[model samples]
Target: MRIRIGGEVHHGDAVDLRGVDADATAVRETLDLAADDPLATVSATPPALSVALAAAARERGHDHPNDAEIERLRAALATTEPPDSSDPAVDLATARRRAAEAGSDVARLRERVATLRGRLRERRGGDAEPGTSAGEAESLAEVESAFEAATRALTEAETERVAARQALSRATERARRARDASERERSRRDALANRRREARAALARELWDEFWTAFDAVAADAPATDHVGDDPTAFDGDPVAGHAAAVRLARRDDPVVVSAPLFDDEAAATVRDRLRAPVVLVSAP
Candidate 1:
């Protein structure tokens, strides 16, 4: 349902289909005028849009008429039953309305052309014409004189048009390359982010298992107060091996050990109170 229209255009020609949503009869009439009239610039009818318009007319209680029938209906729609225009004022008003519409259309077309020229200039860079610098208007005259000396120089209009096309092409190529590179970078960053997330999850699981095991082993041999000691002297019968085991358990996640120690028996009792397991120790040392 989204229709986006943009990109570099090498050609200046345009085909407007603004009133395409109207009924088939109206569309056929428009088409006939477009084909015969000097002002009509619509070159090709879009098949998809034509069909949709016909269907919409049918849904709105107007049957889709055949081409000949459509033409007849269009004539009826455009012309009055008793067409006898004698008043010059009415004719003048009609002419004015049409002139205003034509002026509006021309204004819109000119604006489009100006926009296209601006884009081409942006691609070329700098405000000076192709071969000249900002402060050197006299040099531009000299450049033109030199260009005239060449055996096969293009007409002024043709040269400007060729320059515009080249600028448009370069701009398009740059945009395409930029888009492709951005997509690649985004894909690479997403892959790296996913890898980091997975690594962190694995590291967290490893740390959780290590801490649980160390807490279990310490609780089995120590009083809560000794285990919680801020600076416990090594007891006569304390198991140095148990502390070593805890140290090995804590190493995997790069945990910094400070003066604080776990109140192992109290921690164990709380685990039992909560109906959780006596921490299962795994050998990762």
Candidate 2:
């Protein structure tokens, strides 16, 4: 039979197929052998010879290649020879290389886990270690347990901080209330003292007015200018009472001799000696 394989032409010795049955299995085996041949070239571009090969395969009930067939074809194309089983040194070197790669992967994973743990601790404001008592966490369960404990401790600390703040606020309020009360009491006491002083001043003024009025009346009732002595205007008694008594005695129209206890005893004696009248000097109790 004459056939075109890739861009090359070939002539194969013809075989008699008069009674041969072309089945799906026979066609699949033939295709597999052709693909495995190093000289056989199958183009991946469109309108290529592989299209005619696939059409021939479909006609033989092979249809399209499945995943397993594709993988087998890839493996067959990737390797030109079988691995040497007699070379122990080569096998050992390959194994060591693979082991080194696996170790590197494990180390990278551990570094990633440590980074995540550090971030978690920072977020929680925790000072505790990330792992369990054994140093590195052996399993997910141990890590979970440590995280739960940290969460509980953080919650407790926050609760205590809130309570302390509340206590301080309450104490500050009490102090403020005490200060306000003390200030109000002091103001009330000062106001009461001021009122007492005003009352005493008013009383002193009223007494002075009464004493002056009594002295004027007694001087008016004197018979002669000589008989009338200089007025004893100072007194120790209630001025209102003294003036009333002096007025009644002066109304008698007789030679009046006024005698009263007065605070300015020297002035009273001078008036008494000048008028030759009876006058009394009384000391304040």
Candidate 3:
């Protein structure tokens, strides 16, 4: 059977070891399962052991309930005939219920006893009682005062305990949410990094294509002989063509960074004046 233990899943034994003499192998196996589970307790109580075994079964992913399977396992665990008794182990549910009721009873009884003691103390003193003045320490009044003090102390302690539990619960929830948010942030960052990589790769491809196109145009329009004899200079206003010429000239260098041109509005006037070669106006970084 499946059960929820400490907010986690658990599975019960398949075999009805309830009335059987369980063997060492079954016990060892159950212990082994419990040992692997962080939440499972490894105490001496059979009820606790049963709970751990149940948790182990849940961990193993047993969803269907099978009484026949349980009986088979029970047979393997036993060396003799099963006992005809019902109380094989303690029921955790019943135990918790009883404990809650007992605590309530204790609280009620304490209040009742305090009330009774206060009443009894109030009845002790006569009209002209011994002690100080009328407003001062009377024995009955003192007893009632002490009882009130004790009750107040107990109430304060219980309140503190409740507040502490609530604070811890809130803190745990906040921590869990923070952890979840951190994971989401990490995933988002990784996705952004991948997108940036893709963009850079695409940019590189575009740059390569532009460079190749400029080279091809220059090679097709110019002569293949001596540089000065077959002039490649422009005399007219062809800003677009001049830009392409500058790009081609820049590409001729083995190290492109040293030869790459910087676009300047003043470069058009300079190019119109000196029409010998592609002029590059670049700033050193």
Candidate 4:
């Protein structure tokens, strides 16, 4: 709210450009305020009303998302990729089948070897049964070898099945976590968007109405503004005068610098009268 020009600091609510150059470094510095700044020194422009409302909203801790921010949030909510279970399911089935096949083969071969050994024992230390004893002995040796091989295969298959079970469990847990995460993210985004929208909408309604009433009350005593008596968003008047009034009125403590040209000869007097904030006027050379 304080203006420092030509190494002299002037403190006030309103200021005059007077003989000062419009492009002076101090003038530029005074006019630029942060979005959330309650105080502003700015040229009265047509969009000044919108700017004022936004600043007021920021001070109130309400977020007003711009188009770019809205689009970014939309994109974030659109993409979801979860862990896959189909491939793991197929692997589990394959492992189970291999384990069962190996077990059956081992069992059949063990039974055959047992039967052959029993037959050989019946003819032990005697002349071999020419038709059957020698053949049975050879068959027993082959069946034992096959049983050993089958047993090894069964052990390997059992290991694979156990691994498959673990894989399936991991995949399921991952999928559940993925689903929960996505849902939580989506809910957070939706709630954020809703709050911002509601806050801005409420701000616009209250601020616009307040602006209209204040502007009307000051009409008789203050310099004329080029407003068409409609919504500030649709305002087609001088950017500096009417909206600047709304901005200054938004808060009582903030100093707002105004250009001398926006008003008539009565500017300084009316500024002091209608606006409680003290102002000093200077013209741009």
Candidate 5:
């Protein structure tokens, strides 16, 4: 049987204790002795070894239900309930499309404004050329009238382009707000789902019930060891120091296990103190 202690997996006799009847009294005595002198009391007996391994596994927070099982539970939970709100996905997509259309409109209007301005400039430049005689005064008057009309058109086009830009800005802001709201909703949903998964896993594992029973049985007659501090460093709170200490104890065949990422070679050497048992590191697939 394979046993996962913390994130580390131990196979063969290292963890296997199937059908081995555990004597609560003997296990407790061994634990008490191991607490004081780990090397002397932590022998290769099935019951004692199992208790040690279980305790270690608990310490490292590796006593959860299997990942595949938790994932299955989560999937079932998701299917059983309707989502809290209508999916923001479609809303977000619509907002983005509207923003894009508005931007395109702005671009088109700006192009029109540029064309009108260019025409006005060309007309004015032609009028500036000194090629008009008094006989063509009426022609010059007609040219001036056309130039004024071009100027008016240019002004109207510029005003429309400015309006288009403002509309685009509003649309862009709406899209941004929509995107932010969608993200926040997703994050909230994910956090809720994660909590549900953890609750389900805890129920399935029943580690708390088992650990409490074991603890009660052991504490009934055994004296508590002072090796662990009143507030022992928690794996989640101080991972580096906790993992280091756990690994050190586990190597000495103490009732402790650790699940953590592998440290660098130098750090590992410093922590392991040249021990031969390789530190096992497990990661999610």
Candidate 6:
């Protein structure tokens, strides 16, 4: 590939930028470059090798499947917790118990009122005035008062039972709604996770297919080592030879820039012959 940087036109399949000032940044200003891969790099290794490799994988765009969606779902799941109805369920059970007890109290009160009225009836025997005498009138008044009090108590208890049942119904409905929302949230996350997994697998398969294709095309130019024969895996593991093979696998038209002091002159020349793509080696000042 040919590149023009700062009024200087440079051309070659594998041009060595041997100078005190030609840097990687200068090369990028001239040519569009992909993010650097450290696995092929054997130069001054970065302090955080693992992190750099992880970053390189991300740059290659295969390891993470639907990274944006994965992150979004993760954020949402973390912030929006699932609702639990254990407390509400317990409250409903307790309310039902209280209402049952209140009903029993109302039933017992009715029985007491019936017994008092029967006593008053027996005392008013013969078609005479019910409470003509002072004693009888006093007794009748007491029965009337007791009857009114019992009716009032029964009304209050029945009201309480109705309220409790309504409250429990409302609480159960709310719990059902909460459960549905939680299930939906889980479903969304699960779907995204599956898609991401499938996408990553598809990307890997595509790359594998492309690599073998490129290997077949450039195999003639690539010199075979004793251990690295026809086996593609062996060739892929060679530091100097694999680097050239990688360049061959890259786009045939675009120029990739690598730092100098990483390849020897003789090897670089031989490697250059094997590559289908162009390469520029820049030197750091």
Q: Supply every candidate's count of residue pairs whose N, Cα or C atoms clash at under 3 angstroms.
A: 0, 0, 4, 14, 1, 0
Once fitted onto the true fold, the runs of candidate 2 whose alpha carbons sit more than 4 angstroms away are: 1-135, 138-149, 209-285
Each candidate structure's TM-score, on Cα atoms with residue i matched to residue i, is 0.25, 0.27, 0.30, 0.41, 0.30, 0.44
Higher-lDDT candidate of 1 and 2: 2
Clashing pairs in 3: 11-54, 14-70, 15-70, 23-77
Prediction RMSDs, each to the true structure? 36.8, 65.0, 32.8, 11.3, 15.3, 11.2
Instruction: Please provide, for model 2 over 1-285, each residue's C-alpha lDDT reduced to its tens digit, 9 standing for 90 to 100.
Output: 332323444332221111234332232243343433211211111122122223222322342214344444445434534333444444445545555555555555556556556655554453354634443334444565656665555555555555555555555555565556556555655654454344333333333433344444433432222212222322443342333333322222111112222322335444333322333222222
Ten-residue region with minimum lDDT total, candidate 5: 276-285
Tens-place lDDT per residue, model 1, 1-285, is: 111123312111112222223332333343343332211111112122112222222322343214344444445444523323344344445555555555555555555555555554453454355755555655444444544433122343345445555555555555565556556655655655554344333333333334334545534444432333212122222333233223333322111111112222233233222212222111111
- Which of the two candidates, 5 or 6, achieves a greater TM-score against the reference? 6
- lDDT string for model 3 (142-253, tens) is 6666677667666765665565555555555555655565566556556555543443333323333233344345333433322221112212323233233333423221
The best-first sequence of candidates by lDDT reads 6, 4, 5, 3, 2, 1
Clash pairs, candidate 6, are none
lDDT of 5 by residue, 152-196 (tens): 665666666566556656656666766676566566567666754
Q: Global lDDT of each model?
A: 0.34, 0.37, 0.38, 0.55, 0.41, 0.56
User: Per-residue error at 35 for model 1, in Å?
Assistant: 73
- Candidate 5 matches the true fold with a TM-score of 0.30
Model 1 residue 243 CA deviation (Å) reads 19
Task: Please provide, for model 4 over 1-285, each residue's C-alpha lDDT reduced to its tens digit, 9 standing for 90 to 100.
Answer: 577776777665556656665442346456453444433543433344655665555544555445456666666666645545455545556655665665566566556556655654554534354556666677656655655666666566666666665666666665566668767777858865775565455565556656655565434444555545445566554445455555546554545454535544646657655544455554533
In candidate 2, list every pair of residues with a backbone clash: none
Full candidate order by TM-score, most accurate first: 6, 4, 5, 3, 2, 1
- On lDDT, the leading prediction is 6
Which candidate model has the greater lDDT, 3 or 4?
4
What lDDT tens digits, residue by residue, belong to model 6 across residues 162-237? 8777776776776677768778787978977776555444443444434545444434444554433332333333
